[model samples]
Target: MITEAEKWTKEFYQKRGWSEYGPFIRIGFLMEEAGELARAVRAYEIGRDRPDETKRTAGELKRELVEEMGDVMGNLIMLAGMYDVSLEDMMEAHRKKLTERFKGETS
Candidate 1:
């Protein structure tokens, strides 16, 4: 199934004329998004700029985190598109490497 993110990414790049931005530029953008996400994480951990909820539920906190994470992932997906890198394949390869590295470990 083509995800909403994939569709949005395609249309976004097309609308912004970002298809001309090669892998190098996209990688820089990806780094920028990662930094933004990291800053968001730090703020959340320090209870800064949180919602005015009496009891900050896990869902509320997670929503904020996920929004930042989504930006990071969006940039990563854009970069992958620029380079013809399949995230699914990369994830599978990463999983295999991790499994091999932690063969004797149990959570």
Candidate 2:
């Protein structure tokens, strides 16, 4: 399910006046954000180490991961708004599909 925070994030993007971009540009930007989120995930999983500098602690890395994740989700929500897509309905359908696919799995 899309959380209350996701709803607020969509509104935040709207308030920032971000709907001027075309879908192609927005989708590309969303993909870029997703890439950053992936990097954050990698950092969280393995230490963000550099031979020339000190490695970040797991907690610090987690904070970075969370921020990157929010960026990705914000873009997604923005795209949904631009396309007139209802994330709530989409998530519900997705949940139903997953429930059928994995009957015994706990959501």
Candidate 3:
């Protein structure tokens, strides 16, 4: 499903005639993603400072985290599309790096 996300993003951009501004759009998307992350961190701080508040539950913080994660995924999908990179390939590369690092093969 996540791999298909990249394909859908490419098609969406193509349909909107946005292929020409891929680089710039991706930069903007990354900025938006960073803002969402900041918002999530602020929400976490708010919850952390009021642990005794029954009105603010852990579920609310989880929702905020998921929202920020969605933003990150969306931007990453867009960036991969802009660069014509496959999400599957990236994941494989990451897995290989993780395996090596965990095995003490490389730093």
Best by TM-score: 2
lDDT score of model 2? 0.80
Model 1: per-residue Cα lDDT over 30-74, one tens digit each: 888888788667656765554673556567767878888987777
Q: In terms of TM-score, which candidate is stronger, 2 or 3?
A: 2
Q: Assess each prediction's global lDDT (C-alpha) against the native.
A: 0.75, 0.80, 0.73
Task: Tell me each candidate's TM-score.
Answer: 0.73, 0.76, 0.63
Ranking under lDDT, best-scoring first?
A: 2, 1, 3
> How much does candidate 3 score in TM-score?
0.63
Residue-level lDDT of model 3, residues 3-99, one tens digit each, is 6666776677679875556667777977888887887777776644555745556688778788888777767777776666677878888999989
How many pairs of residues collide in each model?
A: 0, 0, 0
44: Cα error in model 3, Å: 3.2
Alpha-carbon shift of residue 9 in model 3 (angstroms): 3.3
Which of 2 and 3 is the better model by lDDT? 2
Q: Please list the residue runs of candidate 3 whose C-alpha ends up more than 4 Å from where it truly belongs after superposition.
A: 12-20, 45-56, 105-107
